[model samples]
Target: MAVLTYREALNDALREEMERDDSIFIIGEEVGEYDGAYKVTKGLLDQFGEWRVRDAPIAELGFAGLGVGAAMAGLRPIVEFMTWNFALLAIDEVVNAAAKMFQMSGGQYNVPIVFRGPGGAALQLAAQHSQSPEPWYSYVPGLKVIAPATAKDAKGLLKSAVRDNDPVVFIESEIMYNLVRDEVPEEEYLTPIGKAEVKREGSDVTVVCHSKMVHQALAAARVLEKEDIDVEVLDLRTVRPLDVGAIVASVKKTNRAVVAEEGWPMCNVGAQVVDDIQREAFDSLDAPVARVNGLDVPMPYAKNLEKLATPNADHVAAAVRHVCYAD
Candidate 1:
């Protein structure tokens, strides 16, 4: 095992996948010459050359459509947006063209494309650039949404996303690029998509979260432990085909649940999770399923306000307390 930052792990994943498959290529703004906006593609251009690591203009829609076309032509393409906020410009290609091609053609075409980049709020990027769009893509049936909270999961899941025969929207946290690290395996391995893993085990309550929220949940679990509240942390690595079995099992064991997410509350991923729990594990729940989510309003631009608006360990711990009925 080798310790690697989230950014370096992603870089390794792309490098390894491209090395194994001749048809896989990467295309995005500044991906080649500038080495990507977040430097996740650093040194890839020199390794694969301009042909495979081609740079596109600052046009998300055009380049994204090109990727979809390339995928339909039997070449796998990794499309990176500087940030998901910028990907709003390319939703048409992502939702309509790439996602619908296979189903529309009755499985005649496979859109093996991965659209990835930093998502959700970071620092004080403000409302426009700080929005979380996971629910938007996950709402669509044809698209698979993946958000990995750890370096190891990011590397393995990305490799799986690239090889998937369907359109995938891979969201990364802007703040966690260099902030999070993990010991990644040296040998090749793939983290199965549509599975949830219990990061920490307990019996008092279950704290379910995904992406960056997983870290917050883990921290909250630590805080609760001091007060004699055993909190279990479950990370939903894949947001689309959610591991309902895992969720139900954890909720049954704990008899309580609190969902944490970086997105807004209205029709958010948490909302779906709550609904699923109520329907599938209604008898197991001891209290109402609670949610700790980003403020319903647009993300604030002020530093202090941003901190208050985003969900954190304090927020998650409070939600856990509410579900567990603890002070």
Candidate 2:
């Protein structure tokens, strides 16, 4: 096992995949000469050469469409947007062409590609650059969404996304690139595309979350541990094929749930989790499911307001306590 930073794990995944498949290439803004805005693509240009490791002009719509065309022609492309916020510029291609190609063509064309980048609020990037747009793609039927909270899943899931035949949206967190460290397997490994990993097992309450919110849920679990409140933390590794089974099992054991997310409360991924929990595990529930989400307003620029705008450990912990009636 190797203790690696989240960025290093992603780099290793791309490097390893390229070695195994000559058809795979990476293209995005500043990904080559500049080594990526977050340095996730550092050293790839020198190793893979200019053609495979490429840099694109600052046009998300154009390059994104180009990548979609490449996929239709049987070339595997990893298209990195600077952030999912910038991905809004290319939503048409993602939602229309890449997602609808196979069904639109009666299974003749499958756009097997990955659109990846850091997402959600990081420091104080403001409203334009800080929103979490995962629900937009998750709401679509043809796309698969994966958000890894640690280095291990970051490595394995990206490799799996590269190998899959469907279009995948891989969302990373800019603030977590260095903050999270995990001992990743030295050899090749691939996390399943539609699985939820139980990070911590408990019997009191279940906390469902994904991406950076996983960290918040884990932290809340540790705090509740001191108060004799056991919290089960589930890292929803993939968003599209929601792991309803894992969530239902956890809720059956705990009999209460709290969903924590960085996105706005309305129609977010958490809302879907709540729907499944109530539908499948309603009889086991001891209390109404609680939800902790980012403030509905646009992300603020001030550091203090930004902190308040996002969901944190305290908010998550309070929700867990409220559900368990331990507050």
TM-score of each: 0.99, 0.99
- What's the lDDT of the predicted structure labeled candidate 1? 0.94
TM value for model 1: 0.99
Tens digits of per-residue lDDT, candidate 2, 1-327, equal 889999999999999999999999999999999999999999999999988988999999999999999999999999999899999999999999999999999999999999999999988899999988888999998999999999999999999999999999999989999999999999888999999999999999999999998999989889999999999999999999999999999999999999988999899999999999999999999999999999999998999999998999999999998998988
Cα lDDT tens digits, model 1, 1-327, are 999999999999999999999899999999998998899999999999998998999899999999999999999999999999999999999999998999999999989999999999988899999988899998998999999999999999999999999999999988899999999999999999999999999999998899999999999989989999999999999999889899999999999999999999999988998988999999988999999999988988999999989999999999989987885
State in Å the error of residue 264, model 1: 0.7
Each prediction's number of clashing residue pairs: 0, 0
For candidate 2, the per-residue lDDT at 200 reads 92
Cα lDDT for residue 323, candidate 2: 96
Which lDDT value does model 2 have at 248? 98
In model 2, what is the error at residue 175, expressed in angstroms?
0.6
RMSD of each: 0.7, 0.7
